[model samples]
Target chain A: MSSAYLAAVGEDDSRGGWRPTVDARMVRLESAVEAVLEPHRARLAGADRVTIAPDVHYPFHPSTGVVTDPAVVGAVAAWLDRELGTDLVVVGRSDDRIAFDRTASYLGYDRLAERFDAALVDLADVPTRNEYRAVDGRSVALSVPKPLVESPVIVVPSLRPTEEGTAAGAVRTLGRLVTSGADSSRASVAATQMIDPDLAVLDGTVAYGDDPVATNLLLSGSAPAVDAVATSLLGRDVDADVALSPLLSDGERPVAVENPDGVDLSGVRERLTGGRLPPSDDTHPAVSSAYRLYAAASGDAVPPQLEGR
Target chain B: MLSQFRGRLTDPKPLSIGVLGVGNIGMVHLKSALAMPGVEVLAAADAVPENRDRAERAGVDRTYDDYAALLAAEDLDAAVVALPPFLHAEAVERAAEYGIDVFVEKPLARSTEEADRMLEIAERAGIAVGVDHTLRYQPDMVGVKSAYEDGGVGHVPYASIIRLNDGPLGRPPADTAPPSWPLDPNAVGGGSLLELGVHCFDVLEWLFGELEVRDATMGRTLEIPVEDAATVLLRAPETGTTITLHCGSYQWEELPEVNTRLRLEGITGTITNRDHLPKNFYADAARAALENVASRVGGEPTVFGPTFYLRAHYDALADFCEAIRANEEPPVSGLDGRRSLALAETAYDLAAETVAEDVEVPEVRP
Candidate 1:
């Protein structure tokens, strides 16, 4: 059974709000980061180079808890630099939608990478070697990036839900990095098996539950185990998640979440249950149809935004 | 100077027009023009094929990959310059070569200097210029203006307006790739100040004549290329009203509930744009749709009638076309656009100064 460790982050700002500054947040994050990584140090100590893969899919503001906070990554890098002193690399992949460099630049990953003396790598441009793994009787192929395979990795994923209403856990974060013909869940599962990351530190410092919630918490464990814990916090069942279901099944014990700090996990779980991403700005399909019908009935010109959308 | 533009459209029965850059806003202009009486949208152009495809699906007759090629190839009375801010100057210049008038999307130009050059070209070509500063045309804003004009809010000494939206890098569940240029200072000239604040400045100036920037402050919620939020202190000397204007691209804006607030604290009572707005947007929309359908039986059509906010865009474009056909000045002239830019530039300068002032000088220990 894989047990996940949970650590509380910061107290509510007396002035009424959470996280006044990233620097101030980082100061509080360093200890929590230490607490999470302390157990994983034995696994990471042997690696010459450690790659930190974060959820850098797009340049959404960190405060919205849509993306991993750069500060959390910085604190983790600082801890590793102090404790293990391993060669560090922070990696993300650019997709057709947005460039990784652009996302990195906007989210201050460049500065964080610089301060930590870590190389920020775009996995899309990196050399890849095809790797095959079995996911539920299906042979999944992933053109796994060499850096992720070469070094022990620490995946830092934000506590949020994907547009598909599943936890955007450690598996999906890596799922986004690799090129694969398999479905997203299969790709994520294969990528996890390929990278076989040493640790995953879930940045619940801020969590997105329908909207952003400053949970002021972080959890650390193995990639799948952390995701299992995250899936539970997001009020989702592991069996429902295609990516999580396969990993958590087949005689695998349920995720054991150890909250020694006495953090209010139940309260956090309540706030985040049935949470999903905000619907796109595009007019809802039902509303659009109704509007078009209204227009046809009334002899009104269809709205430009509504026209053929 | 912009109020006195010289060119008139010789009154064609169906005003032949071309839409340049059929992106989101350009598409709105195109659709509005298509539905407009006595206006024929001949061609539309966009660099992005997806946008051109969308425009074609929206009923454009022809599409061009290059707007300049469209301007040179087609003879048009006017072109709606809805391209990116950087392209506005060049697009206008190309339209001027064909002696075509233009209705440009706002912040008119990246800077006042760029706007001056564009206006100079239009003046030399004897082509009229209109700007899409549509906030004033919104029904809620119109109601506020009507109430104020009627002196329902007597002697408003203090007024404040705030306009906010999730800019290029939109809010939450980040699904799509946001365009990079909106946050790039070199590409866009500035951030929320130009993107959103200019709209507030235009609407405020429309409400209270000739605003003067008193003091201002700008902030970035993220370490993105530009300031996502800004607050400006302004004085409308003509009305003796000191106004506070705050605009930011930081707030997550969900559709149907736009984040814009305008309030006037008068001696009699506080008047808010919110009060003027419909009590229920969906209910109001149903009413508007019903009214528009009923009107269809008797008379003229309302372009983009189903969407309440988009009516402003339709009315603004309609107003411009009307002014051009009637040989009258555009209601929102190029000078009016330039004036908004000027106010924004002043606010930026003042905000920069405040930031500099906040940086305490190190005491030299000799």
Candidate 2:
């Protein structure tokens, strides 16, 4: 029986600010990370080299809960280095929008990787292999980075909604890391199935709902099972989630979430049910048109900004 | 039309204008020139075909992929130098060869040295140089100036100004690539200090006489190649006022409102730019629009009436045009622009010193 393990990070008593320092948060996250990683500790420790994949899509401020915090990754690194003494590598890909190294540096991953004696790798520059897997009864081929498949992997994804109003979960984060001709849903499903990651850690320290909600919890399990749990926490329908439905336990929606902290799941679901990224366009067209008409009728001037975008 | 160049017998009446670089700010000047009563936008130029197409859509007669081509072909009284700071000197030099005056977008030039060289060429060509330092012309700043002059705040002490925005790398879900020039110190000269602090310097100098940099600091929030944040301590000897100015490109700004705060603390009370802003921008804009239509004769309709900050750009260009028509110096001349750059350079020097001072020196082995 697959289960997503949940652990509540202990409260910060020593410091507070707009955000706690990464080191401070890392110290606080140690217990939670240890608790979640306990189940797979032996398997993870035996791996020659472990790769940690994170949602470092861009350097959006982590406080907004859009991207995973470096502190959480730092905490995981500390745990791995201390408990397993395992060699670790943190990975993210560079895209046309921004470079991986640039994103890593901005998110403090460069320093965190160094502090934990882990190598920071841009998967874009790494060797890749074509892997074909069956997802939703169709073949999906993905050019996956070699490091992801050659070693045990742990995916750390933030608790947030995509611009398209879907949970940016473990599977989707890993899915986008590979090159594929398949549609996004199928590609992501295929990527997860092909990689068969050892663990999926969901960073819900500050979960983004209609706005950012301080959930202060971490959940870990198999990629799809953890994503199913995340989907539930985000108030999403598992059967409605085509990419996630195929991976979930035979007809069981997010089988069993073993919450060690007994954190109220209902209250969290209610708060984070429907959330989306900030609107790209700040000003409305109607306002500009109204202002333009008034400017025209009055023979007064409308600033170019007030005129139209 | 080429025969009517300023080198010949060009009429300043209904000033013939060409806009160089149809980027965001260039488009602002282009539209302002198009809408102004005594100005005619004859041509526009940009290296980007899409930008040229945008200018054509905005109703310019001719568009050139190169500004030099526009200057070589158009018989115009003036050209608006709206290109990147790296290209300002060349753009102005090209405009000068045709004996055309110029209204340049600020910082005027990347550095004081570049500004001096550009101004020297304009002087030799006998062309008036106007810089688009629009902060002083903003309504709130104007109101602050009016009240300060009226002794609303009997000042005996301190002032502060802050300007912040999400520069080229806007906030998420940011999907586009930020321009390379803004983050390149070699191209832009400096980061937020050069981009935004100069405007604060210009406005502060307008309010209080000349300013002296007392201390300064620069910060980079991201791993970008430039300082995204800057703070400067300044002393105005003439006004006996000490001021603090902070500006940054690290913020996530939204439209419909801008991040600019100017406050003067005095013996009597504080005078803030916020006090002058309309309580409701839309209502005020609607009211202004309706009024502009109601009174057609002798009633000055606020240009860029609905939006306050952009109105400053329109007014700044309009003032430059008025100065050009009258055969006088621009209100914010190239010299004034250089003065702001000099202040920024000094702040940079002081900031560098602060960084040096942070380094530990081994005490001599005694």
Candidate 3:
């Protein structure tokens, strides 16, 4: 079983409470995901294989469960197949047995990929480069370049860094995959171990201050830049200790996010490489990287590695 | 030592007047010349046969189709050239050469060159030439001049003359086909400027002394190609005073009642006059208006009036006849006519250059 970890963050509604109610956070997460993804299903028709990463649940916001649940992932895949006329595979990850037992009966694990032209990869541990590359090529038909391990990969930080660092596990894994040439396509196909993925996504909805997977902090507001700026203004380093930790070496100081409040993310999703995600499950790292790439390509910024990435 | 050189009117002798052309204006002169003291309607000529018949019906004794035959006749003492603009020079020259005193209609010739040649011939021949700039003779104009001279209009700061009328006496309708002669630019020289503006130009000069136009602007407002309206500004080179005139084919319905206003601004006060009234009327009106307003405000009226009016046309005509009889120069001689025409021509030229510039008539120095 190949599984994926997905993290979601949302705002806490409770006053003078240690944590926000899970039911309220879940509704907000569901609404934001639906708002972001429902309108663009027709535009994301190429993908065939997909995995549902379990949401990194925290006490700050309950909406974070959407990101951690495989049921929601399967539902989104089914929706993409029906609406966009594309096949998608779905897999789930969860620490709780109740969720898995209840969702497994309704989820067609066998026909999840074949009936909808999709597949489910059940994993017991973190994803390796071979696993990701095989699934990406065979399912999504992505021609990732060989030597992607040596290619410059940028990492964007979410607003809140996880206390335990498990919340941004996807960013670290993506960075490793690129460095190992798992997502690359240009190398001799026979010699190439697997294609390296050059991009990563980090969710900062219910971020953790000390240990993200355990101590949840609702920091959802505007775009990723807004949260990053707010956290920086609060004296928290985003790149080194938050979602951007994967791109930093030891003792590497994080740079401040510029004009985070003034950044207009109105059409950010359309200009992004991947389709837009709902606010509950939005990949802040992905949005920021895409923004930096666009800015650099347009000669608006100096030729330096973008901050946070 | 003013000698009374008035001709004797002992008996009403038939004035031997030769009509050069029986056109509308010519016919008027023909009729008027015949009615004058000691006048005889001896012979008449017209290029058109219809005009000759009209002249005959109007009591011309003999009618000739060709003007040359009429000029050749030795019986006439005076001759009137009522031909189009182009024929004026030749007719006037031929009449002068024949030892006949000539009354040439307005616009002496089609060009300044032709006018100069005709005047020269008349001068050399010692024959009297009277330009029918007839507005100078009108009753209202005589009054305006007298009022201006008597200080009735005080210093005469502004003098405006407006002579707007319907189409010229016998002008054909535009839709009925253009006139063969008047429409011909070569024959007519220019349009309303040469034809009718000549009258206003002469009248202004006569009233205000020699007028030097500082600037002028002209425009065409009618269907015809001629200039229908002209605004002129005049300046007295010595006095440094100014006058303006706006004359045109405007006010078609008010053709018969031409309006003129001469305003004078003096060190003491101001005076204004309209139409043709005796100078006394203007002086009286001015003094009364000023005094009545002053007295009502508890101030005394200082102005008084017994104003005079100038009746100069007959006197002007008598001067011409006396010049002919005494073989002396007329007061307003051919040079005077030429000078006025030259000023008028210059005005037209300036008007063409600055269509909106104010036209000022040049003043004559004493």
Candidate 4:
């Protein structure tokens, strides 16, 4: 049976809000991360070099629960540096939108790296290697970065739903690292298999439902298993997700959290389910259609922003 | 000095124009100049090659990689200084050297001191300096002003204006890396107050003359170097209106739906910009399209009306061109821009004072 563990910080009554103190929160996050990963300590200790891939697709303020809090990554790095004495790297990729180093600096990763003695590595700069992995029935090929392929990766994803209404879990986070010619869901599954991250630490300190909520919990386990639980919690049907279905096709008995005691799992589900990112596109289809019809009849130039995305 | 330029202004064939920056707003001004009847877009310059390409695509006659080179090469009546705040002074200075009048983008300079120096240079060079403060040109604002002047709402007691947009860090599926200058205090001078509130100050003064800054506050939603949000209280003595103006760069703004609110509370009722705006944008756009089509079918001059907000930008630029052609002072002159900057400086000073006072006070009871 697939198992995960949850370690929540702060009291049940203290859950309504969070203080904006990063240093204090990092202290709690370090303890919570330690607790969640305690069972898999042996697996982590055996790996010589480690890399963390966090959900930092944008430079959204961490307090908004839109990106993984740099403090969470710092806490984990601090633990690894002290306990395992492993050379650590925090990895993200640069896209056409924004450079990874700029995103890191804006989101406070530069300072966090300095404090924890870890290197912030943009995977886009690293040399890449092509690898093939079968996910579901397709032979998907992924050109993953050399650093991620060489090291034991621990995916640290924030608790949030993507624009497509699926949980932007460990799988999709890993999917962003490599270049794949396949559709998003297929690429996600292929990338996750090739990397086979040793663990996933979900930073639920502040979770994004329809808005941000201070959940202040950390959950960790095998990347796929943890993601399965995450999808279920987010009210996303596992079968509907192309990325999750292939990875969890074994029907691993409903996630049995080894230490879910004292935490209201049902309450967490109720709070975060039915959540989605804000609309991030051009004019609505109805509006666009009306404008197009008007333009055809009037010979008026269409506004560029309202034109085809 | 004025007599020397009088010959050039009247002997003008078509008013020759050059655009200094072809970024977002720069392109708008460039397109407006191109569409104008008596304006000839001679050349355009931008630091970014892509922006220069866009200007060329917009059908400009020439493109220059540097504004200084363009100013030196092009013999033009007027130039549009659409560069960032830091470059505004330098661009104007270059135009002044060429004896060319300039229409500068908002926040006329990094500070009022910079603006004063730039204006002095223009004064000695015998050139006109016009500021682009477009809020006063928007249809809804025009409607509000017309109604208030006609006493549609009797003596106004209080008023409030709010302007907000996603600032340097834009909203949503982040597509581009936002320019860094806007968030840096040194590069742009202050934040939301200068970025947006300058327009509010100009428009407010246009409605209710000469405002006195009473109290103000500034805040930041993020850890950026500059304040993203600012609120100021002012008293317009002439109109006896107590006004509250709040401008922020922290709010997410979507296209087609802007976040600018202006309301006038009077003895009888309230006058709001909402009443002037199109109730349903799509429906109104369709109506405007129909009107334009009918005008075309009838062989009548097309009004090219509606999309009223963007039309304001075109109108603002057209007014600048007309001012240059007539050799008359611009509707919004360099002094108007300086006045707005001075008011913003006052608000900043008052806000700092409030903070100092708060820190100085100690608790009496232990």
Candidate 5:
């Protein structure tokens, strides 16, 4: 009965994949967002306080399709405030790498918050409640933030692959907001169940496959269901993803899109499949090994960047 | 060994060196010194136990928890001052008291005043002070200079240099905790200008001669305490060239593909650093490795091969060590470091003035 909706907006005529101008991208994003959310508008109208959790783990330039564009969040906020008349909070968490508030500011969420009369909350600063849930037959405990627990949550994650070689979907985006005693996969499942977000809106205006691509589309549905579709689109086997395997039934057919329009789903899958995040270590292991071997032979000091590999 | 050279004695032995604060870049200096011929890495100092562990793994004979202790305990020709900017002054002063020459990492001190005091002490103690301004040592920059000097870009009227990377908060997958001092204004004195712009200032001067800070602007992409991005307009009076230098820590950088671009719009044509860079990083690295191996077989000097960017650090340290051995001023001396700091300070001031001028005044009440 669950279905993910896809809506394409703007022209895609450029030889090497067309990217809409900023104005065109925004207009199209809002149209796509409106179309995707049309099916869930009834539930959205009933919510009082709604919090939008986004893939804002770092202040990576939004144009790279690495992080959710704040413009999309702004458009979503404007529509929610106008149509649903709901109090909104744009939520993220501060980790060791960067503060969520700083990341949001860099991604232009501060102006978005001001323009939409929304609160920019760092989940780390919020009070948390301990919740225990069983994921994959393992007991997982999560210290989920109060704002996310008490509000109607809408997860807006960027279309990208995580370092663990899985789609960083709505569930993982929500999981990143909480403190978990479980491993990443288990933690993501537990947090998603505890939060039970009302909607998952993917910011696929730009997507990071092997590289950034201008997909210029938005898709929305149930958080876990949408993530299942995202998993397939990212060319990942659901059984291979620890988070998706436990959460989604193995026999569940490929999530059928409610409205496909003139979009090329197979083309989208082909372009985004087999994509992975860039290496986050000091240097590649092979390069390090080669450098060390070379250093031994040449009696040259190994560069520190090559050390500790 | 301790009594061999009580203070500045001419011992025919190879230059014995100590590395203080073997963190990321410090480790690079430590390893570079370790690999250089006729130099000994006597000891290394770091506050972090993990860093000391890394230093040991890199073959340092002795390690100290504090740099002051290392300076007090070791017998060495020079020390590499690779501590944070706040500690740079103290580290240099300690080296000075022990009559040990120093090669410090960039942004020589937190400010020009602190650098002046450090340089004065080094001068009084008769110790050489070398600053690791490694841009000049980089092959691409060197190639640009060589081409410019060769009149390949005849009478360049304008030039622009851009250097950007994901600053303290590096790009995802968010591997390590970014050090806090880099973002704190008091701790580091300034942001990208001091951390990265200083390097540009040093390189610009090297390329165009004395540069005059014209108009400037600084921006923070985030609400962090310091500006993460800076753009400065400069005029090189000697070369009669207008230059724009923009540096930021906001861009995401994946290695082997650095985002440093240098372009010269000359009277004849455009000359770019890209023209000299290796077509393929890994291929060039492999070639460098093979050449170094061949050199080893031939009993010739082995250049720091494999990485073009890292080779500069090696060459810079090698130059400093050679300068100390010859009892001469370092090629990139303390004064050169101070000069870059002065230029950055001017840029900051000019940027602040621009901001003030742009501020709108309120209408007078009736």
Candidate 6:
């Protein structure tokens, strides 16, 4: 059965030269996330918990030129509480300073763990970061442990793509969080999801794509589907189904749903029941599945994934 | 009939010539001028002490560290301005002011404005100003001109010239800086085209007749800021014939050969030539035909003739001297030089704009 991972970040767009509206950005993010998640809802329902990594660097609100306050975080927390129940434990990286927002902290793992009895694990504070560091003996290490591996992990990297490939944004920050959390020493995996508001919105109603920082794409309203839709609206090619292919193994394909059409959740459940289990670490190679999907969509052969133990 | 013209060959007095900037190219001209029957090198000057010492070793009796002193003392009929491009305008203007004829090197000045001023000064003084556009004097180029004028290639439609040579920096192990002219944009105007492609452009005009460049582009694909390569598209005014010229400096070998390609689609048949060396029209048709046949079979083009520069210096020098003696216009007029410079500037401007826009221009037919 396929699992759907939904991640979103809310941004404050106070600077206001040329940023998209919050709603528009949300739509784009929703489109992309839904496209990938619609086919895999059954697996998601069976998962232990859904992980969310917020934009900890720069969050702006264009309408009032204010950041996501406690009221805003409470509002989102209240919604997640109502929809996903009290089982949600939002995991974040300690290095993300922007996650320190009072509202975010209020709904953060600490507050949520007490309120809904969910565990809020900061990957940096875990022992996995040091374990991975010792194992790799390299400056840059990304990996996870077995206990955390029980729950499916969805990584949401900062969406800012640079020539050199590393930049501070929702997508990059999320990737860092996952990589840092999964390190043998810092293992805190639950399921990772990266969210950007621009991807959710279809128009230039909010901020344009610029330096991921000082922009609203990395805030709470972000989702992978929104990123794909936003990229498409800007004449860029991005497919959520293909992007999530890395999460599946050979003979086990993840289902994709195009928004504004398709069998919403009801149709997804029907497909999930009949679908086969995704290939395991033993059957599929060690290579990340997302990379395979990316290569295939780009007209290249799907190379062997990460090799087995 | 030929004997009647023999009376014109009189033993005229030798003309005194002064050699300025006794560098490599300057020395070449110096040697050639001294070898001529009615020419004498009155004085030589160079900013470098080593160059002055070398000039003295080469039998130049009067050598000076400064050019102004050399011009003052030497009773010269003509001064050869072989200095760098920046020094050309002042040196030529000063020489013309002294009522001395001047044989300045190619790219007469650093800028088109400077070249114009020099030309104006020389014309007002009634002293001839000859630029060393010696590529025209090459025997192969002469033959090419003859062939086109004689209708050997009927209805010329398109032409192209490719010149790729080892860069001036030389290769590894013997690492050297780029040639002085190209390094200093002010001295050479533009880089590869002004210093080298100027020859190709001149030859193209000579062969195809007057042509207008509908569009052109220049670029620097190397690590340097100055242009190292260029492509120009031109259309003939009379026939509306189209041509593309590609020139660059990036070959590896020391012995660089300029490649020239011409395609002429005539009413009768198409004649195409791509050769490492220049072609000659005076060769026997049977020999040319056999070479073509061998080329087809061997999958290699024929080596038609020797290059243009083999005996070009003598012919060009002779023409300049004759023009002076006969009181006639030089073979390559000043207007020709101006036109070539204008085309080069336009090509550079277009290339800059295209790069800024980051758009590729589609190849279009005239």
Which candidate comes out best when scored by TM-score?
1
Clashes of 1: 1
* iRMSD of all candidate structures: 1.9, 3.0, 48.6, 3.4, 3.3, 27.0
Each prediction's RMSD over C-alphas, in Å, is 3.3, 4.8, 39.4, 4.8, 5.3, 21.0
User: Which residue pairs does candidate 5 place in steric collision?
Assistant: A301-B35
Clashes (N, CA, C under 3 Å) per candidate: 1, 3, 58, 0, 1, 78
Ranking by TM-score: 1, 2, 5, 4, 6, 3
- For candidate 6, write residues B1-366 as lDDT tens digits: 011122253447767888888776676566556544456788888898877876776568888888878888888888888887788888887887788877777776656777788889989988887777765565445555666667876777766667665455332212222344554676667777877677767777776668676666776533344677788887777765788877776443332234444555666655444322334432432343344455454432222111124225544554565666567776666667766777777777777776788666899989
Q: Candidate 2 — which residues are off by over 4 angstroms?
A: A9-12, A18-28, A81-87, A112-141, A210-214, A232-242, A250-252, A255-273, A288-309, B1-12, B292-302, B358-366
Docking class of 3: incorrect
List the lowest-lDDT window of 10 residues for candidate 6 chain A: A300-309
- Candidate 3 lDDT by residue in tens digits, B113-200: 7778988888798777777665655555666667667776456555565655444412111112123466355887766667666776
lDDT of 4 by residue, A1-309 (tens): 688988886553444555555677676676677788778788889677899999999878777777898888888888888888898889999988778887887777887888777889998898999988887777888899988778889999988888788988999999999999988889999988888898999888888888887877888998878888788778789889888888874657567787554677778899989988777756688877876676566655444344442
Per-residue error for A240 in candidate 6, Å, reads 60
Kindly list the per-residue Cα lDDT of model 2 for residues B30-143, writing each as its tens digit.
988887776899999999897788888888989999899889999999999999889989999998999999998888888888988999999999999999998998888988
Give candidate 4's TM-score: 0.85
Best by lDDT: 1
Deviation (Å) of B47 in candidate 6: 1.8
List, for all models, the DockQ compared with the true complex.
Answer: 0.66, 0.50, 0.00, 0.33, 0.42, 0.01
Worst lDDT run of 10 residues, candidate 3 chain A, spans A300-309
On DockQ, the candidate that comes out on top is 1
Candidate 3 wrong stretches, greater than 4 Å? A1-309, B1-7, B10-15, B168-180, B259-323, B330-332, B355-366
Per-model TM values vs. the true structure: 0.95, 0.88, 0.44, 0.85, 0.86, 0.47
Ordered from best to worst DockQ, the candidate numbers read 1, 2, 5, 4, 6, 3
lDDT of 1: 0.86
Model 4 clash pairs? none
DockQ of 1: 0.66
lDDT of 2 by residue, A1-309 (tens): 677889887654444333546887787788899889998787697777889998999887777788898889988888888888889999999889988888898778878887878999999998999979987677888999999999999999999888877788999999879999998989999999889999999998888887778788899988888888778878888788877888886745536888878888888888898777777643567776776677666665445544443
Model 4, stretches more than 4 Å misplaced? Answer: A7-50, A74-89, A126-152, A179-187, A205-217, A249-253, A257-276, A281-309, B1-12, B147-158, B265-270, B297-304, B349-358
Screening candidate 1 with a backbone cut-off below 3 angstroms (N, C-alpha, C), the clashing residue pairs are A298-B293
